[model samples]
Target: MSVQEPEARATAVSPLGTLSLHVTGASGVTIDVAQAQVPKLPEGMAVDGVMLICVRLAVQITRESPMRIRATADQDGHPETGEWLESMAFANGAGRLQVAMRDDAWLAARGVAAEPVQYERQGFSQVIHEAPAGTALYVSAAWRIDCATAAGDVSAWFAADLALPA
Candidate 1:
């Protein structure tokens, strides 16, 4: 029997609202995810609707190596009613773990919790705020892992999805 490798996804969530998208990838893949109402930047900086973002991460040890993971969600809001959420996780062969969250712009950190998991450990972090009408949130969910161990190996992944009414 044979198996195929995972591929980067283009679209993740199908919604009845403004249509926010989630792109997921594993191992060494790149995923491009965005909402249908989000305006394209760089060539044309256009801002239209408001947005909310969230992220989570998990770490797994299969070989002899420590794990290092980091997840970040930066939501540039309109300084009144915007919110952002970011989370990260890592499974180092070492018996140690940490989780944290922060605020950006006019928003504040609301909640962050470490998930109770075994083998494949996970961490959850989030932030929320209401931006001043007529502005949107910049959702950025980013993660990274780096560490070493003497027992086995380690693997880390970060994934997230969201919905925003246009």
Candidate 2:
């Protein structure tokens, strides 16, 4: 009998002008999300005169029972000013999730030019924002299902670079 190697999977690339989320969750659990639109600012109110791109993720998890979830952002080697601006929580049938952003002063101190765009993904969610060049931002989501009978999480880091024209 001859042994055959499995075919290599193709690498997926994120769409231009958008952020992508990768999630891992409990076995037998599934999640789905819709791409979020960028936040709209009032007229004459620009993104602090700096270019920015934001993405929101809406997530839904379907499982047999309830779960606990938490999400956080990790600034990759970037100086943190220790501020949290907004936070909100909500619950669906079997789980709960909260979303938030860093304080304006902290963001300003780090030269983060705009508000974070928040969204959800399979088994996790995310918020993307504009940061200074050479800086990196990390996002993480943790979930516990059936009161910790099964649990998982995902974290991702993205580095800031020159913005491409839309």
Candidate 3:
């Protein structure tokens, strides 16, 4: 499989320090992952040997000061052949999040007319993974924050390991 960049993502103005990920129990940060589901596509819309699962996450960044945050994911399950999906960024706050998709043929075979990154849900964004059946998904959310403080220009990360039901 291949990953494609739909558009150029924004970068932190003054990124500094080491990148970090704040999971549950981390001060002012909480991440909630929804159940993984193998979505049912329309009739004749499925690609042969390609299984798609939707992973949803709702991350609340309750820091007092606002900063620009960006989100990206890596298919850690297969590092060597891992895919680097598209990156999503929020202005002064975290907004929608979506990973990069496979190659054009992979998408075209599934009858996708355009890049599927324009949709957003109530407070969460869809992260569609193209993993083989009976495999676990290890998605790492690499977050970059651009704070105005001298000591606050650092990147952080939070990992979500979801076991797909066989």
The better candidate by lDDT, 1 or 2, is 2
> Tens digit of lDDT per residue, candidate 1, span 54-130?
23223222223212222222211111111442323222333111122233422333222222211212322222222
Better of 2 and 3 by lDDT: 2
lDDT of 1 at 89: 28
Model 2 clashes, total count:
6
Candidate 3, 44-158: lDDT as tens digits: 3221111123222232222332112123232111111112332222223322122222322343354322223322221112223232222222222222333333122112211
- Evaluate model 3: give its TM-score: 0.23
Superposed by TM-score, candidate 3 places the C-alpha of residue 88 at a distance from the truth, in angstroms, of: 1.0
Q: What's each prediction's TM-score?
A: 0.21, 0.28, 0.23
RMSD of each: 18.0, 19.1, 18.9
| Candidate scoring better on TM-score of 1 and 3 | 3
Sort every candidate by lDDT, greatest first: 2, 1, 3
Clash numbers, per candidate? 21, 6, 7
Cα lDDT computed for each candidate against the true fold = 0.25, 0.26, 0.24
Report the Cα lDDT for residue 149, model 1.
33
